[model samples]
Target: MNFKRFLKWLAPVSLTAILILCTIVQGWSAPTAAQTQLHWYGQSAFKLTTPTGKVILIDPWITNPVNPNGKTDLATLNRADLILVTHGHFDHVGDAMTIAKKTNAPLVSTADLGQALVESGYPKNLVTLDTQGNFGGEISLLNNEVKVAFIPAIHSSVIASDGSPAKYAGNPGGFLVTVQNGPTIYHTGDTDVFADMALIPRFRKVTLMLACIGDRFTMGPQRAATAVGYVKPDRVIPMHFGTFPALTGTPAAFAAELKQQRVGSRLQVMKVGETIRL
Candidate 1:
C-alpha cells in the first residue's frame, strides 16, 4: 500500500481502537439481554426491567393534573424497586411520595426536594436523597442491576402542598438509568434542550428515550427533535404533550422532523396510558 493510504487507514483504525479502549475502561462493553428491552408510560413515566428482573421507574405520573383518575393513582401501581424524580415539578412528582410510601420504594430525588416532601407529610424513611450537585454521579441500588444518575436539565423546580408553595427546589434535571442486565434509559423531565446533553453516554445504546415535547413549559417539537439527534437513542418516545390546552406540541411534528433528519425509524409515538416495549 502507498504511504499516504496506509497512514489514512491507520489513523481511522487508531481512532476506533482508542474509542473502544475508553469504553472498556469506562465500563461499557458487551451488552446483555437486559440492554435490549425498555417500556414507556405516558409523559415522563416508564418501567425498565433488568435482565435479572429488577424494575426502575422514572417520574411515575399516571393521572390527569386537572382531574385525577382512580386508576392513575400511583399508590396502587406495581412495585417499583427504584423511583426517580427529575425535579420538584408537581406533574413530574405528583405520585412519587405516594408510590414510595406504598411500595417502600427508595426515592432518588434531590435532598432539597426530599426534605420538602418530608415536611409536607411524606415519609422520610422512604427517601434515598442525593442532591449534592454531583451532576454525573451514579447510585447503585441494593437489588437488581439498576443504576441511576442525576443528569443536568435546564428547567425550574417547585414543591407545593394544598395549592401553596412549600419549597423552592433548585434547578431541575433528568435521570439517566442503566440496568446492568439491560438497556440504558434517559427520561428528560420538563426541560429546554441544552448543549450539555451530549456529554452523557448511555451504557447500552439507549433503547428508549422518554423526552418532554410540550412547549410553553418545556421544549417544543423542533428543539426536542434536535435533542433526539444529540442523544441518538435507539428509539425516542415523545411525551409531556396533549395533556393541557396551553401545552402546544405534538408527536407527529416530532416524528416528521425526525424523518427529515433521517431518524424517523427511531421515533416512537406513545399515547397516554399506552405502553411501548423497547
Candidate 2:
C-alpha cells in the first residue's frame, strides 16, 4: 500500500479509537445512581450521606435522650467527612471530638467555636480555618460537592468548662448545606423563630428544613409553624425537641399548626434511627 493511503486509513481508525476512549472516560467519571441518605438520631443529631458516599453530621448529639440506639449508632459510624456544630452546647457538640478523632473529619463551625473546641481538647489539626466560617459566609468543600453557608440564629453559645466558668464560644448560627446532586438542607440550630428566617429562600430554594420546635429552649409548635411559613421550604423536619421534659412541642402539634397557619410546606417527622433517602 502507498504511504499516503496507509496514513489516511490510520487517521480514521485513530479518530474512532479516540472517540471511543472519550466516551468510556466520560462514563467512568459520571456519578452513579446513589441516593443521598439522611438519618436522624434524635434531638437535632443527623447523619447525611451524599450520593458520592461523603458523610456529613450536623449537631452530632448521637447519644441524646430520644435515640435508643445512640451508643450503637455512634460505634457504627465508620465514615464522616464533615462535622458541623451550630453551637458549643453539650447537646449540639455531643460526640463531635470523638467522631472527628475517629474519622478525621474536619470541624466546620464559627472561628471562635472552632478555636474553643480545640481548647476543649478537640483535635487541633482538624479544626482548621478551611472549614470555619462566620454568619453570612459560605465555604465550598469536598471538591465543590458541597457548600455550607452560616446563617444567623437568635441564640447563645457558651462552652462549659470543667473547673472554669463557661467561656464564650461565638455567635450562635444555623447551617444551610447545598449538596451538588442532593437537596439543600437548612439546619436551624437551637433558636427561636426570627423574622429573618424569611430571607433564607432568597439565597437558595431549601429542600428540607431541620427546625427546632421544643418550647423551653427553642420555638414551640406554633412559633415553629410560623417560622416554616416564613422559610417556605419544600419540606420541614422537626428537630431539637422530644429529648427533655421541657421540650413540650410535639410533631402532631406542629402539623396542626402548619395546617392552621396555611403553610404550604410538607411536614416530615423522622423517627429515631430512621434513614430517609432523598
Off by over 4 Å in 2: 1-32
Clashing pairs in 2: none
Model 1 lDDT tens row, 15-81: 9999999988898655644433455455666666666666667777655453244255454576777
* Candidate 2 residue lDDT tens string, 1-278: 99999999899999999999999998786555898899999998999999989999999989987888889989998899999999998899999988999999999999999999999999999999899999989999999999999999888998896777898999889999999989999999989999999999998999999999999888899999999999989999999877988889999999999999999998998999899998
Separately for all candidates shown, the number of backbone clashes (residues 3 or more apart, or on different chains) is: 4, 0
| TM values, all candidates | 0.78, 0.88
Worst 10 residues of 2 by lDDT: 26-35
Tell how far residue 236 is off in model 2, in angstroms: 0.4
